[model samples]
Target: MTTKSIPDILRQSLESHMAEADLRDDDELKELLGKLNTLSGKVAAAKAQVMARRSDKKR
Candidate 1:
């Protein structure tokens, strides 16, 4: 069986946790939003690194 990718696994886990949380509470929602932003930044950086490596291989 093929293994799930890191991004896919992270997205699934985040969705599951978000569904369980009380988003109606402003404080909790704000915290979750902050965490999401941090995760997004990390994912973007990882993508950039992968792209850079791919470009280097062509040189």
Candidate 2:
């Protein structure tokens, strides 16, 4: 992955950690975790698009 993807990579790590956390009644953290998960999906899609573009350039 490139440097541009670093932040998303970090986000993914954070999302994972948060998911593993025991936030029973923390609505704010719960909402944040959901948002992070959604954002992570977008980041992954963006990364895939970037990789595809790179491959196309090679061809």
Summing lDDT over every window of 10 consecutive residues in candidate 2, give the lowest-scoring window: 1-10
For each of the candidates, the C-alpha root-mean-square deviation to the true structure, in angstroms, is: 4.7, 4.4
TM-score of each: 0.60, 0.60
C-alpha positional error of residue 15 in candidate 1 after TM-score superposition, expressed in Å: 13
List model 2 lDDT by residue over 19-46, tens digit each. Answer: 7873343687657667766876788798
Model 2: what TM-score?
A: 0.60
What is the C-alpha local distance difference test score of candidate 1?
A: 0.68
On TM-score, the candidate that comes out on top is 2
Clashes of 2: 0
Candidate 1 wrong stretches, greater than 4 Å: 1-25
- Estimate the TM-score for candidate 1: 0.60
